[model samples]
Target: MVTFIEKGFLYGFILGLSLGFFIVPYKEVFPMGEGVTETTYLNLVDFIIPLIRVGVITAVIGGLVGFFFYRKKIRAYNNK
Candidate 1:
């Protein structure tokens, strides 16, 4: 589970970097709206993107790993 979480974090980091570099601009991928200035936009790219990525990926991977393990254990128990 921990390993899966760590891998997810790493993957999220890569994803965030790519998002910040390309998709985030033009308010397309995750729009901050028209009121946001360039400074705020840059700040978001630096801060918000990683935070969002980490959170999303951590939850997703942790849940998936936990579910798989739980199901496996249940199956094993049922077999016996």
Candidate 2:
């Protein structure tokens, strides 16, 4: 159970960091001629912060799921 939780956390952290890398290149582009000036910029901090937050949430959920499955398996084994 502890191992599952640790693995879940590691996986989640890696996935989140990779996603952040992908998001780093994102740029919001505003088209001109719509009564608005064209603008493009990357908000690295904003994007990364959310990715980290989601990653942590995912890690917790994954850990809980692993724990639940482990418990279920143990129960089934004992019943047999």
Candidate 3:
């Protein structure tokens, strides 16, 4: 049980951190607004802040999902 939760958090953290590379702030993932006509590069703080924010959010979500998914297995193991 503990191991499963730990693994979930660990994997989630890693996955979230890596996601930063693919996703960024105001990325217009589901764009329905006007198209961009300009471009600009992000500074260190600008880029990093989003990464950290996304990382933490994803990590928590990942941990929770893992816990729920493995809850049954954990109970079964304890019964044994």
lDDT scores of the candidates, listed in order? 0.58, 0.73, 0.78
Candidate 2 lDDT (Cα, 0 to 1): 0.73
Cα lDDT tens digits for candidate 1, 1-80: 46654665566556655555554443324446897633423455566665666557655665566567766777899999
Backbone clashes counted, model 1: 0
TM-score of 3: 0.68
How many pairs of residues collide in model 2?
0
Arrange candidates by lDDT, descending.
3, 2, 1
Candidates' TM-scores? Answer: 0.41, 0.67, 0.68
The residue-by-residue lDDT of candidate 2 on 1-80, one tens digit each, is: 78877877777677766765665555676768768777676577867677787677767777777788788888999999
By TM-score rank, best first, the candidates go: 3, 2, 1
lDDT of 3 at 3: 73
Model 1: lDDT equals 0.58
| Displacement of the residue 60 alpha carbon in candidate 3, Å | 0.6
Off by over 4 Å in 1: 1-45
RMSD of each: 7.1, 3.2, 5.0
Error of 2 at 61 (Å): 1.7
lDDT of 3: 0.78
Better TM-score candidate (1, 2): 2
TM-score of 2: 0.67
